[model samples]
Target: MRASLIQIAVDPDESVDSRRRRAAALVREQSGADLVVLPELWPTGAFAYDLFAAEAEPLVGGPTYEVMAEAAADAGVWLHAGSIVERGAGFDGPLYNTSLVFSPAGELTRTYRKIHRFGFDKGEAVMMAAGAELVTVPLPEATLGLATCYDLRFPELFRGLVDAGADVLVIPAGWPERRRAHWTLLARARAVENQSYVLAVGTAGTHADVRQAGHSIAVDPWGEVLAEAGSGEQVLTVDLDLTGLGVTREQFPALKDRVLGLAEPRR
Candidate 1:
């Protein structure tokens, strides 16, 4: 299966509307790809916490959703349209860092609200409500486990997806440039541990004084890096051997040895 990961630059100078339009155009450009993925919070810079409320949109019929749905149909590809700051129902309702998936028919297939908020007590942690459910989307070629940004650091989340029969893990992030190494390391680790394909896409450039780590990457089931982007806006495209996932798992058979439901560790 062919996949295109668009590492978008989320600079402060670009207006949210302009970025949304640009993102849709980029998605439309990947006409022949089987799947196209974008970075997290590309519409209104992830770290731009102050702009979250101002740029927040509804889950359905929002500008980002409308534009990306059309782009998916135009490109005829299953598109992971990154994430948006979602304003839930009612004025006082919570906001969610939500990721959207659309099919080739321009239909909203699934939405994964980010489970792990970035900030500890401030920023996203306080601003957005955590998503309780784990989401997986089934495609003709592979089943995708959805995750976003900080969720990558938690191995248990990926393991849960694997338990639910996800073969490919798709992670959209807005990781800072300072911790770029961790981003790459963790992505490969998740793939290796789960014995599944991992596509981790992140933003580029700077916003809210934090520079984004743009090394969007694709890792195979055996922890091989197939493709990676640079520290700038780029579209990293790779052809994934969907069958290789099962082949590697069968050859290695490590995941089958996992010991689940262990007792709590002693203090």
Candidate 2:
């Protein structure tokens, strides 16, 4: 299946509605691609905590979701509308970092509220609610494990996705420029350990004073870079071999050897 990971450079001045319009257009341009992904929180900056209240849209009943649904139908392909600031009734106020995926039919497949909220001593913790569940959205081509930026650091989550039958792991991030090396290393490490395709998409330029490194990548089951992008706006397309993945896993059998129980006392 053809996949297009769109590395968008969102303008700080652009309105949420305007940005959504442009993102929808980009999705249509990559019409032949089976899955087209966008960067995390393109409308509101990743560190723009203040905008959460202003831009927060409900999971189903909002302009952002509406746009994603429209784009998926228009392109006749699966659309992963990177993420939006999700505001809802279940929560006290709103959830800052959340992602949503739509099928070709525009059906809502998965909703992932970012489990690992990035504090880094700054203050994201004060802004959003963390998700409690791991999500894997199934498609005709492959089952996609959903995760936002910081969640990539947690190995258990990726393991859960693999156990949940995720063939392709999708991460939409607002990774900062300062820790870019960590981003690349972590992505490659996840692919190598999991033995599955990792499609990690991020944004270029600065957001809320934090500069992002836009080196989107698609690592194959063997941890080889199938496709990669620079620090700019680009769409990376790559083909994956799902069948070969099964063969590799069977040969290694590391997953079967994984210890799931509690640890023993130190000697």
Candidate 3:
């Protein structure tokens, strides 16, 4: 399956409306790709926490959702439209960092609200509601496990997805440029441990106080990097074999050795 990861530049000067149109156009450009993925919160910069409230919209009728759905239909590809700042029922209620998936027919296939908020006490942790459930979406060639930025720090979540029959892990992140090494390391680790393909797509340029890490990457099941983009706005495309996931797992058989017994108390 061929996948295209769009590493968008979230400049502070760019308007939300302009970014939405640009993103949709980029998705449309990947007409031959089986899947197209975007970075996290491209419409409103992820670290632009103050704007979340004002920009939040309902998941069903949100502008990002509407534009991306049409883009997926036009491209005839499965599109992971990164994430959006979702406003729930009440305007005064907590918002969510929600990721959306659209099928080739422009139908909303699945949605995953980011489980781990980035900020510890302030920012998203305090403002947004955390998602409880893990989500996985089935494609024509592979089952995708959904995750967002901070969620990469949690290994148990990826393991759970693997156990749930996920062959590919799709992570949409808006990680800072300062921690680019960690981003690449964690992505590779997740793929190696889970024996699944990892497609980690991140943002580029600077947004307010944060400078995004734009090294969008695709790693195969064997922990080999297939494609990686520079710290700029570009589409990184790669052809991944979904069958290789099972082949690697069968050949290595390491995941099958997992033990879940309770740890013995010390001294």
Q: What is the C-alpha RMSD of each candidate to the true structure, in Å?
A: 1.0, 1.6, 0.9
TM-score (all chains, Cα) for each model: 0.98, 0.95, 0.98
Best by lDDT: 1
Give a tens-digit lDDT track for model 2, residues 167-220: 899999999989999888999989989988999999987888888989999998
Q: Write the per-residue lDDT of candidate 3 for residues 1-267, one digit (tens) a residue.
A: 999999999988889999999999999999999999998888989899879999998989789999999999999999999999998787687799999999999999899999999888988899899999899998879999999999999999999999998989999999999999999999999999999999999999886779888999999877789998999899999999877777888899999999898799898
Off by over 4 Å in 2: 90-92
| Of 2 and 3, the candidate ranking higher by lDDT | 3
The window of 10 residues in a row where model 2 has the poorest summed lDDT is 88-97
- The lDDT of each candidate is 0.94, 0.87, 0.93
Q: Which ranking of candidates, highest lDDT first? A: 1, 3, 2
Which lDDT value does model 3 have at 104? Answer: 97
Residue range 1-267, candidate 1, lDDT tens digits: 999999999979988999989999999999989999999999989899899998899999999999999999999999999999999999867899999999999999999999989888999999999999999999999999999999999999999999999999999999999999999999999999999999999999997999898999999988899999999999999998988888888899998898778999999
Error of 1 at 88 (Å): 0.6
